[model samples]
Target: MLTTTTSKINIQVRRFTIFDIENLYTYLTHLSPETKKRFGPHKFDKQSIFDFYRESDKNIGYITLDNENHSIIGYFIIKRGFLAHDRERLEGYRLTLDNQTDCTFAPSLADHWQGSGVGKLVFQFILSDLKKMKFSRIILWGGVQSDNTRAVNYYINLGFKTLGQFSHNGNNLDMIYSIDQSTGKTDGGFDQ
Candidate 1:
């Protein structure tokens, strides 16, 4: 469990539970349209999320308020030793370690809690947890629309470098960012 003192937010990062499915679904539904279009089309219904909790619950991680509020702010799926099939793009980017240790998908705080540094705090918590898990490397990928300069700049400022850019489904061009474990830094350059 990692807590950020600066925000007065106590975050406990732990395995998912059957009880968390509904909250996860609610949170996903409340995501901004732009955020949904970028990282989503999630395949989780109540039953599916519950089943996933039973199956890979050991590896899946979630961060929630430590108080009675029990609010789920963010969640991430981490694989201790290999990238799942869904993480193939991350693998193609050559960002995984021989021991794997990669974060498949991580979504920030729900819309209401965004822009309050909750996302950065959660990310830092994940990084600290990864180090304790003996992971030598960690990486995440995000697709940014050319027009969304804010999203691109956010990733760059967070230490991600553009690996390349490609068009998907015809007109949507997406840029890939990669961070090396050794340096934990990015080049901060755009391909175009």
Candidate 2:
């Protein structure tokens, strides 16, 4: 879904399919330990990967690749519905989001690819794709860690607003990104 080239890197965002196991394995295993931690410790082997997307209707991930070599370098995972973990946190703040219109996302890039201007391109594509799907609200999956300042700042700059904090297995800050569907504008507030 990436529409423009950045830093001479042609990135393409494509929905994951069962055929992409090998590519996904290569991408996941090549990531440094820190990157993997940030992305979560999900099984990426053949069988697990296949089972993971079996219910593709509810959960989908976009694989972003450097089109030059056609290798996956990042991911944007979107899970439809108010994920149970997220629901509890939002409720703590007295905010109950709509499951039908809201979805949670976890966007991550390979260590070397991060902060290289490709993230903006990836997010641009993601926003357009989600808008087409008629998603009214977006929230970060699992919430942002209290100490992860870089990620916290990144989300804030991209129009995510903090609803409050909740201790859900860890200290996490609930964030919401609201979109004005009629005008296609995101009016999510930011921390000042």
Q: Identify the candidate with maximal lDDT.
A: 2
lDDT of 1: 0.53
**Where is model 2 more than 4 Å wrong at Cα?**
1-3, 168-170, 184-192
lDDT (Cα, tens digit) per residue for candidate 2, span 1-192: 343454567667778787888988888888888766666624767777777788456788888887678889887788886777556667777876787789888888888888776666666667766788888888888888877776787788888999888775578887888865776442111011
TM-score of each: 0.66, 0.86
lDDT of 1 at 71: 69
Off by over 4 Å in 1: 8-15, 57-59, 66-68, 80-99, 141-151, 169-192
Question: How well is each residue in 1-192 modelled by candidate 1, as lDDT tens digits?
Answer: 444445565555555566777788876677788666655423546666666556663455565564546767666565444444435554455654454544433455565665666666565555555655656544343445555554556556666556455455433222332334564422111111
Error of 2 at 186 (Å): 10
